[model samples]
Target: MKENGIYGLIAEFEEPDQVLAAARQARAAGYRRVEAYTPYLVEDLAEELGMHNTGVPLICLLCGITGGLGGYGMEYFAAAIHYPINVGGRPLHSWPAFIPITFELTVLFAALGTVIGMLILNGLPRPHHPVFETPFFEQRNQSHFYLCIEAKDPLFDRTITQEFLLKQKPAHVWEVLA
Candidate 1:
């Protein structure tokens, strides 16, 4: 079914291998934008689906470095340049003094970035998803394996896509409602 520019197709598999095989077939058939849900991780599914590496970790790293540098810069500016407080003959730029706060900020930013990046990447805080409308999908966290091909696929058409999914020989295939 299609709604709000999102199209859903449901395919069920009796075993993980079947799901993986279906994913491979879908990939060979030029279906790229698809998602699979399973109770457990499937080793070859990601590769079979041609899902590429994500940049969330890289974003977290960059944000962490920025936080560290920002912390250090703030300390440098406050103790060395902006205020220039020389207490008890201590150096204006106390590298050791900046270590604690810099480390703390680095970790804090990295953690915050990781969380925010993950939420953003995952489209989280979503109270509802079209996939949930599939009655069989409740077993997604149990024993079933499901693959959904979104309507956004350039080559997607309900009839042809359903035919292709059936060719995969899934145990049961149902339409994912929009």
Candidate 2:
């Protein structure tokens, strides 16, 4: 099934249910590496892939903490240590004055972290992928759903995987090439 050098085996499905069932079947069959493509969102597909716990929130939290500390420290150093100008008999180390800027910085950094983390996790800016070589690729942009079992997977075998995909009752099955 080496069509122009095989990257993997891809199956095309007509409905989200078919793709979801196909992904579940692949997972149940001990296939650890599987990918699904669809024209729109299908939440169950991601659940089947066990992609529920992304670390974006943790990244955002760390960034927010760092930003808050940095902002507060900078203000503290500037007013309390460097300048030390007491205004209206108020203490030089006034934490209340730092709260607004510290909060702002925390939100800004957290937002930035969320964006950067998402792009990094999703492998963004990727202009090309081997799946694009499949003839059914065009259909993916329209209405078709695709599930691919990568060749690099530990359980992959050309004949066996092809048979497995065929058993999923897809519209078409192809040997994806790099």
The global C-alpha lDDT for each of the candidates, from Candidate 1 onward, is 0.84, 0.89
How well does model 2 score by local distance difference test?
A: 0.89
1-178, model 2: which lDDT tens digit per residue? Answer: 2234678899999999999999999999998779998899987798897677778899999999998999999999999999899799998988998999999999999899989998999998799988899895865657899999988888888889999999999999988887
TM-score per candidate, in order? 0.88, 0.90
Index of the highest-TM-score prediction: 2
The residue pairs in collision within model 2 are none
What lDDT tens digits, residue by residue, belong to model 1 across residues 104-163?
Answer: 999999999989998998899999888888875775547899988888777778888989
Candidate 2 lDDT trough over 10 residues, lowest sum: 1-10
lDDT score for residue 156 of model 1 = 78
Show pairs that collide, candidate 1: none
Which residue segments of model 2 deviate by more than 4 Å? 1-4
